[model samples]
Target: MAVRISKILLVASIGALLLLIALDNVFDYNTNYEIVSHVMSMDEVPRDSVISWRSITNPTLHKLLYGFIIFTEFAAAALCLAGAGKLWRERRAEAVRFNAAKNIAVAGLALGLGLYLFGFLGVGGEWFQMWRSATYNMQQAAFRFIGSIGLVLLFVHQRDD
Candidate 1:
């Protein structure tokens, strides 16, 4: 029962974190949007003759991509919150039932991990060379998100049985 409650707290905490992030992104739109814009545009990266084609300079496209990211963050948060609620409600159930209640939270964490690892690290970092930009680099932040969420994900995945 203690373990179940702890798991609920961890999952809910992640959900709250993601919700805050999405809220921050929306409320402080220009700040994070600028970061995303710079990463996508590769404006801060040193000109590499071979990699010039990877840059996306279109403002409309940048806005679209940023919107998509914000939407994803919201979705992950909602799913995680819902999952946490489910887990809490089922905390006193049998072990198998409690274990079964973890699916949504896992999906939420997986979405977050995917966003940080694949979206930021793979697409932004590798494809757009975001790491080369001292002003716009997001690799470190992305890694932190990935690592933290991943750890929570692993912990939540533990079987109550």
Candidate 2:
């Protein structure tokens, strides 16, 4: 039962993290939007090199990207919160039944992993060269986010046998 409780707590903590993330993005919309905007526009690239062509000059694209990010965060938060509830309800059930309740949490974790790893680290950091700007560099933060939730995802994925 200790293991079950641990699993439930871990999953709930992740859900809380996701909830905070989503709320931050939604409530403080412009703050992160500015980050996304600068990263995408590459305005602080610090040099007049031809690499500037890679920057997005359109304002519409900036809002679109930011909106997409917020939407993804909200989805992950909803899934994680719902998953935590499901896990809590099944915490006292048999091993197979408890394990079955992990599906939603798995989906939530995968969504978050994709957002941080693929979206921020992959596209924004590498493709957009967001790491070059001291003002807008979020690669480290994104990596940390991925790592923390990823460990929980792995832990929660283990069979309850």
Q: Which candidate ranks first by lDDT, i.e. highest?
A: 1
Q: Tens digit of lDDT per residue, candidate 1, span 5-100?
A: 888898888899999999999999999999988898888766765897889999999999999899999999998999999999999999999899
Compared with the true structure, model 1 gives a TM-score of 0.97
Per-candidate clashes come to: 0, 0
Tens-place lDDT per residue, model 2, 32-115, is 989999999888885586677788978899998888888888888788878888988998899999999999988988898899
Name model 2 segments beyond 4 Å from true: 46-51
TM-score per candidate: 0.97, 0.93
Regions of model 1 farther than 4 Å from truth: none
The deviation in Å at residue 104 for candidate 1 is 0.6
What are the RMSDs of all candidates, in order? 0.9, 1.5
Whole-model Cα lDDT per candidate?
0.91, 0.87
Worst 10 residues of 1 by lDDT: 44-53
**Poorest 10 consecutive residues by lDDT, candidate 2:** 44-53
Clash number for candidate 1: 0
